[model samples]
Target chain A: MDQPRVGLFVTCLVDLFRPVIGFSAVALLERAGCQVEVPTDQTCCGQPAYNAGDLKNSRSIAQSVIRAFEDFDYIVAPSGSCAGMLRAHYPDLFKDDPEWSPRANHLAQRTHELISFLVDIRGMASVENVGFEAQATYHDSCSGLRELGVKAQPRRLLATVEGLDLNELPGAETCCGFGGTFCIKYPDISNRMVADKTADITATGADLLLAGDLGCLMNMAGKLKREGSTTQARHVAEVLAGMTEGPAIGEPEKAPGT
Target chain B: MKPQSHLFKENAKKALNDANLARALNNMKAGFQDKRRATIAKLPEFQDLRDQARDLKNHTLENLDFYLSRFEDRVTEKGGHVHWARTPAEAREAVLEICRSVDAKTVTKGKSMVTEEIGLNDFLIESGLTPIETDLGEYIIQLRHELPSHIIAPAIHLNKEDVAETFRENHTQLDPNRRLDQVQDFTDEARAILRQKFQSADVGITGANFLIAETGSTVIVTNEGNGDLTQVLPKVHIVVASIEKTIPTLEDSATILRVLARSATGQEYSTYTTFSTGPRRPGDLDGPEQFHVVILDNGRSALLGTEAQDTLRCIRCGACMNHCPVYGSVGGHAYGWVVPGPIGAALDPGLIGLEEAHDLPNASTFCGKCAEVCPMKIPLPKIMHHWRVKEHEAKLSPPRFRQGLAMWAWFARRPRLYRLGANAAIGMLGRLGAKRGRFAKLPLAGGWTAHRDLPAPSRGTFQQQWARHKRSQAPSSS
Candidate 1:
């Protein structure tokens, strides 16, 4: 079989806050023997605009996105959320633009959230079991589990990791309630939910709280720090790709001078 | 008043983002909810009661036509009129006819979602009759010219400050300086304002929680006692409800109530549980002189045999709404329906037609909290999935979405092509994003990447890594 020409849609979370995941994606892809290319002009999948009801901006961005990767053999994301958004909301954005439908359809078909891309498409039932392990609990990010069908991909990938002890948290799928702007908008309610999620994570006694999306991790980690909990938060990609020896996933470091 | 169904998001956004509104919602987390829980906890037989209640409701639903007729029989026997309304228009007409028959100028109403469903207050006012909502929450929302966001807590989105503002704007005569104070103070003030309306009203209208067939009685549960006043004070008391509410016996209804308070507010029962079979009895001191029960079908019967038929199993406990993360964030207004929560998600498609409400089903995170809290154990997420399937089948989803899924479905079936396709994806992404190691925008991905980052596809898909592991596995095993 010919080596596949792959395009990684490294999510903004990894690019801006968690760069190790992006490097992990590249290293992992190289290990898999696929030619990896990061398209330079790529921006975002316009989820904030789409979710915020600014369809015009969303369409404008989607057009740019479609143009950038339209030539790719396949488009993959480390994020189940970004991949889901690309696959799910892209067509809706271009529904009225008659010429763009096929292009959008082609892109959506090739798009994959990393783990789902692994388990469902690649049939990767096992992965390099590098001795990087932890007793960690997994969180099902809303878009990942529901929209992108990433429920078992992360689990399967994690299972293949040599020393990783995967434990189940009760109510694993409940939103940490960090719905992007929803956290800032409903802080009290969001705080309550995040605290509940933190309590669940702490209850597991898992050294690491692992998830696919950084949005939930950041929101949860912030709450944990504010509440002074010792549990560390990491992304599922970081875990599966064996790249967790980094700053607590997404939080920016305290500067030299403030 | 403003045709709220059309501008749902604007209203919901206003409600959701408002810190004042969130503060107002805090009362709900504690007050009605805590009280309800306390009452339910005090009752040991609550689960047994819920089981009986579910069975009772099942029986009523199965024999709805019979129980409804039986209710009609008892109403007629008590010298009250029974109006069978197959639609909202018919129900509205039945109400207008009664108003015109009595030349009613003023109407006092208990908290009733059915009346809201038919736009009764708006219709009555349009027909030139004055209608007032006696339930404090309903009254607050009415004054705000808004729809109730909750079945039980209609003004749940409004804080006490908002209420104080509304009261100050509407009822100016009272010394407005008195802190607008406690809930009791607010209720007392609201009572004084509504007492005269109740006493002088030409008619009273209430929604029936349950209609008992054996005794031909209509039951209403309330915490504030306003439903009783709305039923008792006027010259005529008109009961507006859908056909699904009737049961064969009061004992059956009591069973349902066991779960109702607990699931809704965590209460064993509301403070006031009134059963008004008809108008005032001859010996009754204070009750309406006439009674009328108006049963509205309103597209519910069409749902009877459909896949959505199990949706009727909902008992309006509000637990689904209370536990829904989406509803908790967006509030009920965004659903653009009277019932807005998990129950609202499933029921709205059937009631309003799938096209208008396709967004409702898709709005859920599918956290399954609603199904968990649902006393009936309704599989809300599965039902939502069914709606998505139906949406896809109807070609209601954009053609591009279909083409995308259809293509994925294609590759998904063919394992080799899928693996090649997958490897090709991660390889290309890794190459393009080699510099920054992440692409913020991609051809079609910018729709999402524009707002959020797209973490570059990692080096080879997990399948390639698995292959290496397999080759390595032979060495380890040997």
Candidate 2:
């Protein structure tokens, strides 16, 4: 079979906050026998606009995204929240438009979150020759867990790792309250929720915490740092690609030994 | 009842600071979720049943006017009267008229959220009638002059010790030092007090879980059997229910009931799934002498063909709230309305107007757990989004928020500019926080900084790094 050409939709959060996750995703896809390209025209997934109920801007942003990545055999994102925006919500944005609706629907069909695409579509059983020796737990970002059904794909890949002990976080599927603008809009409620989430994360006693979506990862990592807990947070893609040499998310920019 | 939904943020903060309420909410969070999960896992056909229930509700809602008329006709045929109420005022007036016809004095209520919506208890009290709540939770909250914090579990925000205090203050005749330490003790005390109110009441009002058009029956499902006594012992039984509660047939009610109990409190079936069709008939041993059904629209009719129509399919299971992290954190009273949690967040804006209920739809994290657990399969997050659209359109959101969104969207549409801007912003942030890797505080980000440190970005944007990496990778080949 010909190698599938995949367009990388490095989400806005990952693009700005942690580009390493983007690189990690490319490494995983290539290792799984796929050619990957990060389209230059891609910027954001229009999720901020879409979530804020700004449909007019969400449509224009989505149109730009469609035009940029429509030619690829597949489109994948490291974040499920952005991938869900492209795959699940983009079509609804143009449902009534005769011209853009079909194009949006077609793009949505080809879109996938990185881990689910790696496991379900690409039929990649597990990461080969990759090992991370640490006790870690995974938090299921809401969109990835519910909208994209990405519950076990990450675990399936992590199981192949030689020395990773995956202790499941309590309420792993609960939201960490990094709801784009929700944290700012209702900060108190969001704080209460993320506080509980941090409590649960610390209780797991895992040194490292992992999740697919960068937004949730950053939120949890920030809270953990504020609480002065030693548990580190990182995107799951980084661990899967055996790219844990650098600092974990929200940590000083230096290798541990150095 | 007066709709403090506008103060949602303030209410949520107050609820968070409440230590006793926090303890109560934590207990509820663990109890309801585990029970629902365990009950749902045991039933293989649960998912299919949920689909069927959703379809059934969709069908009935599409033909709501017709089924409602059929319900009225069936009730009339069985010597019962059905009154149509377009607003809460009209519904309250209709109930008052029925009570007046029977010269009612003391009225017993059996956990009717619709009555709360219509402000029936306060209205009755002001109009010289005594209204007594019979449901244990409802009774507790009523004595405290509070609204139902949760729809199904009225006093869920109260711990047992809080209840003991409330009972000690109100039940003045009880032995002052009687041991009310245990759960059974509280229930026994409530039962003894409510029994007299049940016997002396001239009228009883209850909410219908399902109103069957086929048999003119109104169903009430409860664990305490208080509703059975509330309706059966009264001379006049008035069921206050919204028009959306109507179903075409008794069998349709059965289909919904299968999911309702499993979704609510995780029972195979509520202890008493009692159905009352009409007034007492000849030779009937125990039943109401007069039966009146007040079918209320109260802003629901406007949702028939709109984006929020799916919310009308809600069975009030409380599963959404049970699984909701926000609801679990702040508890239900913070929603500041009759129905709370996801259902209130989605439906309240439509009922109470977006300007007043704007904060509700915005309070959620869009976790979609509510939609996932909804037995009716209502897209609750989607409905909330619809309200957000309306809120934005009305310019109800703070101008600062809208301006920030506009600025973000404007920059995002231009890929090159967005890349450059992001690169510049991230570079600055990355440099400032390189030593610590996170910011303890940041300007214009107090909301985030107040609770958690903001993680600084990597040194540069991904697009910039990707472009440079690509050039290096193909240095000689290209």
Candidate 3:
């Protein structure tokens, strides 16, 4: 059979803040024996609008997303938050529309989060030749864990990477408080949540912090860096795809001598 | 009591600065979350029970009128009176009329959120009657003249010292310097004070966990047996419940009760699950002489058949708040309403108005944790979003937030425009913070920068690099 076609939905945060995650997603998809395509017509999964209670704009944006990636065998996103929007919420966005409802439902059926697709759909149990010799902890982003059921898939794959010690962070399933616009809307509450999360991440004493979504990664990484901690945060895909040669998120390029 | 939900942001800020609240919230997180996890893990049939509970609520809600009428008929046949109240004023008046009929001066109350919703104690006070709270948590908050910050744990925002202080202030006749450090000390003092109110009160007002339509009974679950004393010892027992609390049968109530305590306080079953069929019967000696159930609609009936209809299934288990990270951080008072947390964010707008409670809905991170822990599967975040949609359509959202969202949505619809904007923003930000890799303070991002640094863009946008990478590989691959 021909290789399954996968459309990579690079979330907005990953596209701007960290492109390596996008690259890592392509590499992982290719390794899983799927033909990956990046549809430039896609901008976002319309979560901001939908979450902000602006359904008019949310529906309009969701239509463009459906049109861009409808023909692919599966539409995959590196972030569970965005993938959840595509797979679980898009149909609800157009539920009342006779014209767009079926189209939205069609796209929802094909969308999958990156790691879950690799592990569950492609049956890729382990990485071929990747190793990260460091103590690491993984945060289960709320949407990915509760919405798309992307819990064990990332862990199962991470276990196969050579020399990687996965320490389970206490309250690992809690939100990192970078809830799209939530961090900005209610900064006081959001700050307390992220502060608590960073303390837990630091308590693990793991040198590396990993999560599937770049938004959560950026939030945790930013908090960790601001607190003057040495724990580096990166996308789970970066480690799985052997793309750790680059500096971790929020890290400057290494000096020539060092 | 008057619905200060409009001040949620201010309340949240105050709650954040409170060290005592922080200590109490931390303890709650460690205590409630671990207990619920362990309790649910022990029950293999917990998930199946949740499904059944959810479906049963859905059926009852779909036929709410039928079940409510059946409940009224059964109560009347059993010599109990049923009072329908469409507004808070009407509900308050009905309770006052019943009290007047009994010539009651003192009223003892079991833990009831609906009474809190109607602001009953204050109303009773205004009408020249004394109302005492029997539940330990409720009595403690009552002594402090404060609203319940939590549903089941009314005084959860207060630490032991705070309770000790409150008991000292209100129980002035008792020894002020007595030992009150231990948990049992507080309970003992509260029990001693409340036992007199329970026996002397002429009317007892209690909230029903479930109002059975088939058996014409009202069920109350309490750990301290306060509800039983509050209902049985008084001459007149008044069961005040919202319209959505009606259940079709006793078995349905049992199924939901199984999850209620386990989800709320992590108990297998509350210490006392008392069911009162009606007022004192022919052979009854201890129960109340007159029984009255006040069913308040307030604004709940309007919620039926709407997107928020699922919220009616809420059993007031407080599980959603216990597991909620926002509630964990800020505690319940930050919500500035009778009900707080995820369920409050979803249901308060319907109870109160959307405009007044606007901040409650948007304050969430949309974490989905509340719904995950909710036994009835209310889809809390989704309903909160529904309130948001209404707020947006009504133009009730802040002008700046609305404009920002509108601008972003406009650009997002045009992919090419969005990419160009993203490219320019990323390019500039990437160059600006190339040295340190993040921004400690940035313009227009003060909210995020105030708490944590903002990570700078690594490089050009992904689409730009992906285009270049494909161009670089095209010559070799083809």
* DockQ of each candidate relative to the true complex: 0.06, 0.65, 0.66
- What class would a CAPRI assessor give candidate 1's docking? incorrect
Q: In candidate 3, what are the lDDT values of residues B52-128, reduced to their tens digit?
A: 99999999999999999999999999889999999988999999999998899999999999999899999999999
In order of listing, the candidates' clash counts read 73, 0, 0
* Residue B211 alpha-carbon offset, candidate 1, angstroms: 0.7
Q: Tens digit of lDDT per residue, candidate 1, span B285-365? A: 888788999999888988886767667778787888876766766677767888888888788788877787766665655
* Cα lDDT for residue A102, candidate 1: 81
Query: Which residue runs of candidate 2 sit more than 4 Å off their true CA positions?
Result: A255-258, B474-478
Two-way DockQ contest, 1 vs 2, winner: 2
RMSD of candidate 2 to the true fold?
A: 1.9
Reference contact recovery of candidate 2: 0.79
Per-residue CA lDDT of model 2 for A1-258, tens digit only, reads 369999999998888888788889988999888999998888889988888888999999999999999999999999889999999999999999999999999999999999999999999997889988889999999999999999999999999887999999999989998999999988888888889999998898999999999999888998999999999988999999887776788888773222
Candidate 1 wrong stretches, greater than 4 Å:
A1-173, A176-208, A211-232, A235-258, B1-19, B22-49, B431-443, B446-452, B474-478
lDDT values for all models: 0.73, 0.91, 0.91
Highest DockQ among the candidates is held by which one? Answer: 3
Tens-digit per-residue lDDT, B165-227, candidate 2: 999999999899999888899999999999999999999999999999999999999999999
State TM-scores per candidate. Answer: 0.70, 0.98, 0.98
Considering chain A alone, report the TM-score of candidate 2 relative to the true chain A: 0.97
